[model samples]
Target: MGRDAPAAPRMAAPAAAHAAPAVGDADRRRARDIHVAIVGGGGTGAAILHDLTQRGLRCTLFERGELTSGTTGRHHGQLHSGARYAVGDTDIARECMEEVTILRRIAAESIEMNYGLFIALDDDDVDYTAAFERACSESGIPNRRLSTTDALRHEPGMNPNARHAVMVPDGTIDAYRLPLQFLATARAGGATIRTFCEVTGIDSSDGRVSGLTVRDYRSGRDERIAADVVINAAGPWAGSVAALAGVGLPITPAPGTMVAVKGRLCNMVVSHLHPPGDGDIIVPQRNLSIVGSTQWKVDDPDAIRTPPDDILRLLDRARELVPAFAGAEFHAAWTAVRPLSGRTDAGGRELSRNFQVIAHASDGAAGLFSVTGGKATVLRAMGEAVADDVCRFTSLAIAGRTADTPLLAHREFFRRQERVHEPV
Candidate 1:
């Protein structure tokens, strides 16, 4: 039931090939082959920078705070195998399934292939198991069912009341480390990663984006950065960024709250076999077993609070899968805003998690684009899709190598430039 674009104020049309933005001598920017300005330094932005830089495109990425300060900083960190959404959304399910293997290959060091267990706690869950399995099979998400006893043996903390269980390829991830890897690789490949930089204004001329005005949060100094193309990968704040160019991005900030508890409640990720619901999934990360998430619509991504009721509900639901969670003791909690691709009055859960890359030329603004929606699991794919738009706009023939190449270690991001690439 997740919504796509065309929800409010009308969505932009798909761009026609060869309609790249117009660049002129008046545009003030660094003298480079082709410069792409990336606004936002989260997973999506970092991925875009990685893809473009690997293809020999120069890129400058700006983040208002630290790299993972936005929605990227706070997440459930589930490396989705696409099993959860297979029953409802085939496309997203397939995307997750395909990306899982790719990420395992490219970012192996940051992903935990610990696998996952879906427990059906009641007779209703048992009856729904067949449908779930069918959907996973149909969506190409490999899975195997397990007996209640066998399942408990694997996860000693699993609820004994569980009637059925299914094993999925789901796992945990280092959300921050993964993106930092992307950013680091991009930097090693000659892209600039700027932290504590806020985009203050987007400058446009004759319906074409010329550049953006950025302010250093530390220095309180403004600088103008021009580029052949400007990318809006601002996540939940994408709409506001587009507004600076007098464009309507049709993005709704859907915020979800996740709570982490002390102690690892299980050895693997856990979830309910039923439809997507609040607090239905449990992910064991390191020494902490994190339970998430409750979705709600919010206007401002920055002005959100984790509701006490949400924390209680999450604890109650998580305990159903693992009784140990009932008294695990609270560790940490936070809210993350998802930049869902459409503006709708629909409930947050009803909105789709699919991503959309919009070319502003279709909306009468050239040289600008925005990418929103999807989760951490599909970040590279999201970047590839958007990088295609950027490439087409720049009239470059470079193909994406993000899927094959391992990133430069995050610690080496600022070291002497080195290219991270794999053989074609």
Candidate 2:
């Protein structure tokens, strides 16, 4: 989360409403006064709102708590180059590469292009490293193999037993800054944002979404906000939002936990280059290191919390990679649920990392859409696809120009940076 603020007054009123004359009208007169209600305020939701507002559509972002008080705020802060997914999910890898390139150029102040190291700590994995390099290269992710001596020279803190290493174009990001940047630009474009507002229900009429019922957690007052379309960008709680609409969505919550060590144990993001498993990546953040994560399916997203055992497991694995990390002081820990879609028949781990944009027509519902199951790195592209779908459904003539537009001014990013930390 960026910084906390005192509560503000609610929006003056729901913007003017536009109704569809018929179900299949070709020139379905667009909602001139388009008020889009987004269900989350994390990176994905914020990006969606920014995309909508950039296209000249009005938006109201509803957050249950502070902005980025979700997965976006708790991530390991690695701005991927898709190298992590290159071996298994090439599609997601390509998308990540494209998005990371775009984000680095547009949100320069929010990102630290520190690059990343994928190391093989044992001789048994050196062959795997060769294959990994080939796969990353073929997937268009820049990957270069490094000799053991050269690798150790760059990362003396790395395991002395490391047999091989590959440098990929990954980087650390200020997860908090990126979403706030998106929210700030969205607000500048006339979008209204409400925090501590929990969406209670979705009001529909004649099989089409009409409005939303929201309750203020602090004030204990409920209000109905009219909208032409409702987008479920609720992160791990996306399924819950769909349930409020009486729609059954199959989103499984996969809980992952991260622990913050008191100091930077490594200057670069370090990965074991193994398949998705327990704490295999260590990311360096400001004044500390974020080591994560353990992935397991969970029944509830909201009930997630870091367990003592999880921290112990992470510390054990972290020490195996960097000996100094064995005694690193613990700062804090956090857990977030990643929305995973698929079934037991097809292992969830084997499920595609690509996002699914499900329009309601297939589910016998209208005016409701869900964008689910994608990593934070590619939120921009996912946002573009979602905004385009919304415009198509509402017949809004506004052009989708978010990809070309920078989300924040350089001056604004630096100004906020000065306020958040002591200047060097």
Which candidate has the top score in TM-score? 1
RMSD of each: 8.9, 8.3
Give the alpha carbon lDDT tens digit for every residue of 366-421 in model 1.
98999988989999999999988887886666567677566655565545444332
- Candidate 2, residues 1-424, lDDT tens digits: the string is 1121232222111121111222333333234367788999889898898788766666788888988898888888988888888887888898998887777655666776777888887765676776787778877888878887888887777787787788887888888888877776666555677888889999888888888998978688898989878999997788889888888887777778898888878887888966666888888888898888887777678867678899899989988777788888989988888887653444367777788877775555588898888988888888888998998997765555555456664244334342221110
User: How well does candidate 1 score on lDDT at residue 66?
Assistant: 90
CA lDDT of every candidate: 0.81, 0.77
Clashing pairs in 1: 2-351, 2-352, 3-351, 3-352
Measure candidate 1: CA RMSD: 8.9
Among all candidates shown, the one with the greatest lDDT: 1
Q: For model 2, where is the 10-residue window of minimal lDDT? A: 10-19
Angstrom error of the Cα, residue 256, model 1: value is: 1.3
Candidate 2: segments with Cα more than 4 A from true spot:
1-32, 345-347, 409-424
Clashing pairs in 2: none
lDDT of 1: 0.81
